[model samples]
Target: AEAEAIVRYIKDNPSDNIGVITPFVKQKEYIKKELESNGINNVDCGTVHAFQGDEKDVILFSLALSEHTRPETYAWLKNNRELINVSTSRARQQLYLFTDSNALERLHDPSQEDDLYDLACYVRSAGTYQLTPKPVESRALGIRPYSTATEEAFLENLTHALDNAFSDGSHYTVHKEVPVSQVFMENISSKDYFYRGRFDFVVYRRYQKKEIPVLAVELDGMEHLSDHIVKARDEQKEAICREHGFELIRVDNTYARRYHYIKEILTQYFRS
Candidate 1:
């Protein structure tokens, strides 16, 4: 939630004047990778120490952890006044703070007051974004909608680009939520972990009546970062694509925004 929100803000704003400060170096590095993957390398991102003597036009502060994920660390951070003070005061124009709702669900030690809970209330973002997507749950209940806002926008633009590129009777078509194993022509081994893993979209080239699988695309956002399981899944997907002689484009939200950038990428493998 923190990473996606931060990346979206940076992509739309697109300035070196922006800064990101997270409480932990682990989360800070995770977010940095997400930004860099999206081709956003200019922003200064680090823990509070990196911003001690600096300010930015826009500042995003992410708690970047839930009690469930890291209990002792979160317990320590939620009460640290210095952490909150230094992080929030660095923003010149706009300040956005993010934390998971689950993190704030449990009460802090009432014996000693903590400012982070108070801060979460003002932001109303102790995972508010995580719960507020009612339309996603209402509309697509079965198999999607974690970060549907980003995915929806990207798919709309990508679909349009694909249509325009194949204007004279479109030859290739895009499919969403497709299984990774299906991309292969050969039979599957029963023990593979990613056999049931799904790709964001698969593009197939149509020749006569047969639709040949031509390319695969994955939209990676902040969710893809920091999770060891997700990283392992990515490595498996890449390996599968390589072994099967299939073309896979692992795109960041940065690349997904531009219809032209996506179009240019597809044209190399699937020119109409």
Candidate 2:
């Protein structure tokens, strides 16, 4: 839908030196194919890296990843702020991003709190030319809501339990939905850990005045039991955490109801 709109706009405005920027090679090819099929052949489409050292009067960026996509699927783009900078800055006069608002909101990385989410908010507020369809509660521009009620309830409950368990002396702080990219791993390249995964919750113990990460937690849903990809990713995360000497605690959703068990697991690490 976004690509079609862009092509149509370019067709209407023949004089604008418009370019399409995508994060993945396959996406670039897909956009190029769409443009050619529509008989709009003048505009150039390429990945952000390919467009470096080049500038366009107007640049259309297609953020292809949706809320359902796993972080590892686009870890390279998510971790590399330089690539986003290159893509956003390549436009001399105008820049437009085609992204799902819900996906942008649901981005699960505190490290990107300023970079991605804040930038999106800034652009929405500051940009002069805006084109958004009418708001619909059931369907948000053809994108379904990202989080289900069950997930939201689980997260809330877990957060409340952690707060109650750790609120006594500030011995530990519980952070939710922390990106693995923010946590540095020893003897590993930045490229290796970039966007690899995210912890559902992280417990950081206070040492002197600084907070040090001590435990990473994951709340496994039923999907993790049956999904091979999810299992593989979880294994990879466990390996990385072990390599870095960070204890990872995996709890099934069924076990989440057992408050005593949860507290016991957390207390064991918080004291260590």
Candidate 3:
């Protein structure tokens, strides 16, 4: 749940200076690994003991100890004044606490003034949020300003192929790093989860003033994901394009670099 929250938060606020604080070094390392595996590597993650002087625009403080799992550690955490204080005080704009809410409720005694119990009360004052997990899209990973060299090569090969197939007239146009919403002609709202989605390439046919999309291309790499996760994410992207009345193609690295194969695909699609 903590990993999921961090991933979703980072996706929504891609540019924010984010940091993650956890009581245990193990949790800190695990969160860092998960983020990197998901192609998110910008946020800083550390233990609360070393986070005293640190402040970020947004901080995700994780109470790694839960009453059910580790009662002794949970008690240790609940009584530690300095740990709770440092964890709650290091965010400039937003501080999100990730914990077992049921545990918090069970541990908080209204009759007693405890350090961690008081911190739990404070978070409740700020309003507790339960984040439900959502589908993690591969196309939405690695938010960047520029396209990869592999993607650029695929576009160049596709462009040349288009020229050869439609020598008599312009039958197809190819674009790179196009936004998914723009391709689908959907109005973007801040609440839309896939608004950050971008097609690695899009194939279109121009009609004087308007360009009609027929194909959306995704250049697949290890950066997005691998194995079964890659298959699932690819299926999701394909379904999304199908819903928007276009074909979505995912090109693996070796195939993406081939000029003849790219030309052949353009010819087959636009020739008919």
- Using TM-score, give the best candidate's number: 1
TM-score of 3: 0.43
Candidate that scores best on lDDT: 1
> lDDT: which is higher, 1 or 3?
1
What tens digits encode model 2's per-residue C-alpha lDDT throughout 1-272?
66777777788888999989887787788889889998887898998667755667888888776767666654555535555565555665677777777775566475532334434544677643222322222212111111233234445665666677775666666777798866654535443544757787787778799877877778764335433455666777887776677788887644544567777776676677
lDDT of 2 at 56: 79
| Per-model TM-score on C-alpha atoms | 0.49, 0.43, 0.43
**For residues 1-272, what per-residue lDDT tens digits would candidate 3 score against the true structure?**
77777778888989998889888888888888989988987888888766645557788888764555555666677656556545544565677878778877776655643556545554666734221122333122222211344456667888778778766776778887787777776542332434756777888888899998878777664334423444565566666666666777666544655788877776676666
- Model 2 clashing residue pairs (backbone): none
Candidate 2 lDDT (Cα, 0 to 1): 0.64
What's model 1's TM-score? Answer: 0.49
- Candidate 3, which ten residues in sequence have the lowest lDDT sum? 137-146
What's the lDDT for residue 44 in model 3? 85
Candidate 2: residue 125 Cα off by (Å): 1.3
- Predictions in order: lDDT: 0.67, 0.64, 0.65
- Please report, as a residue range, the 10-residue window in candidate 1 with the lowest summed lDDT: 134-143
